[model samples]
Target chain A: MKKFAELLENLIYSPSTNKKIDLLEGYFKSNNTLENGYALSVLSSNYKMKFIRVSEIKSLMHSKFDKTLFELSYDYVGDLAETISLFWKSNMDIANSKKLPLLSEFIKNCENKPKKKMYDYLFNLLDLSNPTQRWAIIKILSGGLRIGVSEKTVKKALSKYGNKELEKIEKIWHGLNHPYNNLFDWLDNKKPEPIIDNFKTFHPMMLSNPIDEKKDFQILDHKDFVAEWKWDGIRVQIIISNDKVVLFSRNGDDITESFPDITFFSKKNVVIDGELLVGKNCQPSSFNDLQQRLNRKKVSEKIIDEFPAFIKAYDILFFREKRSSKFEFFR
Target chain B: MNILDSRLNIKPLNIFIDPQHPVEKAIISHAHADHAKSGHDKVLATKETIDIMKIRYGENCAKSFQVINYGESLKINDVDITLYPAGHILGSAQILINFKGQKTLVTGDYKTVDDKISTPFELIKCNTLVSEATFGLPIFRHPNANEEIKKIITSLNKNPQSTHLIGCYALGKAQRVINLLRDSGYKETIFIHGALEKICRYYKNSNIKLGNLEKISNLKDFDFKNNIVIAPPSALKDRWSRRFKNKISSQASGWLSIKQRVKQNQIEIPLVISDHCDWNELTKTITNTRAEKVLLTHGNEEALVYWCKQKGIDAFPLSIHGMKEKVEK
Candidate 1:
């Protein structure tokens, strides 16, 4: 936890991309694989267990410390966890205890606990941890790390440490679970790559790059190029396999729960990359209309009726359990 | 007693301490641009400050100059005045005003932690204490200087193909960073921007042993890998910094303690090396003075004022002209 907190602090302070990668790489090199995997999950905000909420943490702090001072410090610091971490006071003996739990152990303890048990566990954890560790713990429990690191940057660091391509990690990222022992084993070459049988898993999408008109036009041939309408809606990939269908955003986050209307597709076992948009009678609505149905955990009937979502498919990467070749792309 | 008359002045005697505008009789605190301005009629400060002022502004910075050493007493208009070490920069002094046994200490900018370059701070008992609250918040507990300096050494060791460009204020912060590097046993020749050459020379002339320094403009080749370059904060992002092959932008300031500030400045390495006191040091100094009233000046004065009120000390923010905004120190 101390090492993870230091890595988060360094990432927050370092604005340079290369330096952040260096910090993350050094952390991966020094820590154990299980702890590093959990730390990476926390950094990328992919952890499934949220042990405590922000309001509960605030109420717990108010119960222990003076209300007015805590409020004042909160206002000054402009961050709840940081203010509490700096202002929290605990018994010296508890804080100096040598039996501190590791990052993986802490996460394992918090999994599947009752709310009351979780609160007591967090109280004990806060007492036993230093300010930095307390901060990391609170941030992890709150489910928002906001430490200026993107998921891609974490993958880049992993690639640097494991001497693999970033695309390879991103290709298999969404298929893995927390405390990914198999993933680390694969990275360390101690075991074979994990066979992901879940065909609903996300595949890394190829992003488009801007072309310079003056320089790029000199070497290009217009006859060989095909231009498609650039949609302003969000980029999504619809993966339909066997009996399950999933929608992934650009970073491979599963947004299948939000766009239920787009799940009605032919069962051809295919992966289609397209722009998720809202439309009526084949006329696409404004991008603002599509924004009304984004990021919803449970979509209501009225919202689905008002903003009916559909995908404007651009390319089919896979069909009938076979990868589409480049010849099929320009067909 | 009037403490404000168009500028920060003492009534009945008419002495201005670090007044922003030009004044007839001015008691300059330090050679920082905001505190020690030129065009004063008669300027009184330590000899090193006067020399710095002459270097910054021309020799005609003031009509006449009076040099005063630390702890020396001088009588002006029946008011006994003395200077104490402020520990902010070279020759920085805290003015101690004594009139009819009513004492008020004006600390322009000070830090309790002793940086080897400046004279250490001394606590003076006074009736009212005027302090600079640059880092007057509980969250701003600065780490040790040696620890912060070790970060740079570690980075240099880790990335041997990159040049570490540290952005700092030229006067106090630049010299202090150089001195810290030397103290940390960094024997390489530290490169500096052209703007820092004069002030660094001033620091060197004042008997501060800053190891070998070479100006960035003098170097013919651009092979500064694994080297350290000190430049003004503004030059860190400008075209002047593009000369280095792979430069890592870092900043040395108290504001870097805040994550938002570091992100806003795009600082790669944030070294929290401050010239002013942190929250604990500020509160400690104020309490040790045993002053009946406190007047807060500059950065985060409201927080410090609230802190003082909680401790039953009569405190309020002092709004002085040209001192409202914080200059990069």
Candidate 2:
């Protein structure tokens, strides 16, 4: 946990992308798969583990200190775990060991514990572990582990050892779970790669680059260049696969519920990338109409009728595995 | 009661307290890097502080160096000034200035607690007092230096297999911790990084024995077991620390009273050892000075100002636009 905490600290402080990649790679190479996979999961956006709140941490701290003093410390530090860790009176003789439990074991022990028990557990753990390790445990369990490691960068770290492209790991990332033993086994060449079922996963979306003036236009032949009129609406991808329709934003965030009308397209095993506007006609509508029904967990029937969303297809990446299946987005 | 400026050189006297900018005549209070800046035309400080400045910026730190002693009075122009022990560091002093029968005291950085090294703080009666509030918040109650050192020693005994990398400011804190550790009866030679060589040598030259000090050079040959290494805080977090196979990082600062900072720096062992006065000391010093007016500088000024108002003492926060207190090393 100390090494893992140090790795997180290093990653957080490193300013350059290359340095971040180096730190991640170094950590992954030195640590076991359990620790690496958990770290990756902590970095992922889907993980949500709030075993204890800052309020609870504060209450626990009050047990050991004066209430007003703890409040002052909390206000001064501006972080819950940090305030507790700093002012925590430690009896150095009480089961203090340089060795800490593995990251996986620590997480497992924390799960299913009662809140009162967890308070004691965490207090004891904070007493036993050093400040850095204490911070790591609190950060991980509080679900505030934002060290700037994107999902793709994690796959890139995995790619370094396997000699595989980052896309290969990203393809199977959504289907796998944390502490990815099978993923590690495949990367280690101890087992074959796991084949994820049909479009159940999110393929890392291909991003467009800006056209450089001098030579980009020169290399592009008139026949090869395909220019579509750009729309001001939110860019989206409509994935129709495995008898299910899923509408994803340009960044691969699932937004199927936001545009239920657009999910009924009569297509299967196909992913079409396009712009989503709030109009039914072939012409694109103003982005103002789309804004009314966006970023909402639930859209009312009246609003949906007033601003109906539609998608205008621009490019097709995968079509039914039988026709044009062997397509590479980057190449 | 505007004495030495907390800001660098708004007035010429600021150069005396903060010598970042040169001035004609400067009366320095202490030898902490923030207070004793290099490149001054003329510096008037304690004899020990001048020695520390000479070691830091070389013998030519000032065009003319005048050594003053505690309780000694010196007259420059129409100002009558006296130096008093602040009990902050080895050569720390509080300046007492009197002009036309009114007295004002400028304390660079001070603490009431006895560290058994520097001269103890003596109360100086003045009409107005300018004080440092670095740990002025009521939350910042520093633990005893001896107790904090015992924490380090206990950890060292517990984790004998790992090297302890103690992070501190090179000039004062590194030497203070080393002295405290030596006084705790740990006879082993403490390893020090190259950055601390100059200041550590200065302490040695001042007749302070730090007990079997070794300079860390070749990592491959250095022992990693049951050893304590003192280096600048920057060295603790940088690639320099990776050489120790089994190492624990520790930071000694007043800021360790705030936990998030300790965790943010990734310090394993936090020693709440500080040279500046904590909240109680700040208030006590204000009361002890018998000052009618108080000026707070640096840390948690607003809170101190508000507290002073409730106590019926005229107080204000003396802040400069671009001046930052040198809390971090």
Candidate 3:
């Protein structure tokens, strides 16, 4: 946990992208399966330890410290977790617990505990830990690890050990749970990879760069480039394999439930890349029309009929061996 | 009668000095935003304070101006008013109101600590004193400011390859820190954010020698390593700081005295420099004023009021909803 905390601190301060990747790669390389898996959960903001909140910490602190002093310190610090980590008074020796508990062990203890019991458990842990470790614990429980590590970046680091591609990691990512021991064993080539068919998972989609204004058309060959209208609607990758369908935004978030009207496609193990549009007929509508159906859990029938879902399929990748190389959207 | 209520309850003399709301006539105690507001029909302040008001709120800050200086006494509706140096900022002043042989003092966000750039606070003998308690608690005893400045120099000397990004308030703190850096024999050019450029220019126009200062927006491909860059606290944490390679974030504010504040701000180094009076100075100022009664405004008023009562002075907390404790910035 200390090493992971140190890694997070370093990653937060390390400005260069290369340095951040190196730090994460070094952490993943040295840590064990459980540690690396839990570290991944925290860095990706998916840690599931929500037995405590910032308000609870503030109230607990108010009960312990002077009210005026606490309020002044809170205003000055501008962060609740950091304020608690720095000012939490403990009578017990912090060094009594010589060896810090493992991340998995902490999470295991937090499972299904009542709010009161969890508060005591967390208070004990906090007392025994240093400021940095305390900050890490609070950040994990609060689940807003804005230390700049994206889910894609974490997967990218994990792929380095497995000799696996990003899509393979993303495909199996959602199917696994916390402390991914089985995934680690498979990555280390000690066991076969676990496969969960018909489960919703995300896939990294193809992206395009802005056109360069300085490049001369005379020197460039038109045959090598494929030009398409730049649609304002959100880019989506619809993955349909084994009668299971999931719609992924460009950032690799699963939006399958938002546009359920377009989820009932054919059962081919293929990934279709296109723009998520809205309107009747084969022609496209404005992006404003599609905005009505987005960011919603349950789309009403009236809205579905008024702004009907449509996908302007630009390219398709078959689930063949070389499916990664088959992206011809910008060919 | 309360000094704050005098602006409203005292009719005929509808003159407000540092009133929270816009009034027909406002006597600004200082150029700090909370004290000197725009939309006043007439403004009475020191020349420097009026200039600062113009810089902050433009020429339309007041319809008319009556510029007063330190020790200059004026009569406003049978009340004798005088401005004294508050030493909080470049143009900050304390208003001393004398009515019918009774004197009441309004110290608007003052500091007694001696500063290199701003005027030092002068104690005024009065019957009653309304003091700001921005750092009123007993625990807020500030350390030696010179020692704080040496810390920045030492950090720069140690991390010669990293640019030390000093985060400070744009108005007074930035100018004061830069001037202190100059006085400490830091000969290198200090890069500044665009937000500090106008205030820095104002400070320089007032003949405060800020040596070798340049705005970062003007410099292209400039070497920031081993250089000092002063900016607003907000800019140092944002994407703007990414332009410099190997930068260290340092906040130069009195709030940095707290370990929690230092950690929360993500500051690598915390310089405990302030423009407001600390607990000791606040007590010292009250004692030196020789006032029979004391009125507290802003900060932990209740604690200071209790301390005053312990000293056998008639003390009360002034519940001025219009006044803001100028903390940090």
Best by DockQ: 1
lDDT of 1 at B317: 87
Q: For each candidate, report its DockQ versus the true two-chain complex.
A: 0.38, 0.16, 0.07
User: For model 2 chain B, where is the 10-residue window of minimal lDDT?
Assistant: B6-15
Q: After superposition, how far is residue A319 of candidate 1 from its true place, in Å?
A: 4.6
How does residue A296 of candidate 1 score in lDDT?
86
Q: What TM-score does chain B alone reach in each candidate, compared with the true chain B?
A: 0.97, 0.93, 0.95
Residue pair clashes in candidate 1: none
Candidate 2 per-residue C-alpha lDDT over A58-112 given as tens digits, one digit per residue, 9 for 90 to 100: 6666777767666765687777666655556555455345567777777778786
lDDT of 1 by residue, B182-284 (tens): 9999999999999899999989988887889999899899876899999999999899999988878888998676666677788878898999998889999
Q: What lDDT does model 2 reach?
A: 0.76
**Candidate 2: segments with Cα more than 4 A from true spot:** A53-84, A87-99, A215-218, A241-243, A265-267, A280-282, A321-331, B1-28, B31-45, B48-67, B71-84, B87-90, B95-107, B111-131, B137-296, B302-329
Better of 2 and 3 by TM-score: 2
Q: Please give the lDDT score for candidate 1.
A: 0.84
Could you tell me the lDDT of residue B24 within candidate 1?
Answer: 93
lDDT of 3 by residue, A1-331 (tens): 7787778666765555665777788887888888877777667644455657778777877887777666765665666766666566543355445656787677667776777898788877887886667777887777687677677777777787677776777777766766787888888788888775422455455576666667766567888886788777889888887787778888777788988788655765777778888888746788888888889998899998888887888777555333645565445
Task: Report chain A TM-scores, every model.
Answer: 0.91, 0.85, 0.80
Better of 1 and 2 by TM-score: 1
Task: Identify the runs in model 3 with alpha carbons over 4 angstroms from their true place.
Answer: A1-33, A46-105, A125-136, A148-177, A180-200, A216-219, A227-232, A263-265, A281-284, A320-331, B1-129, B135-160, B163-249, B255-329
TM-score for all models, in order of appearance: 0.88, 0.67, 0.58
Superposition TM-score, candidate 3 onto the true structure? 0.58
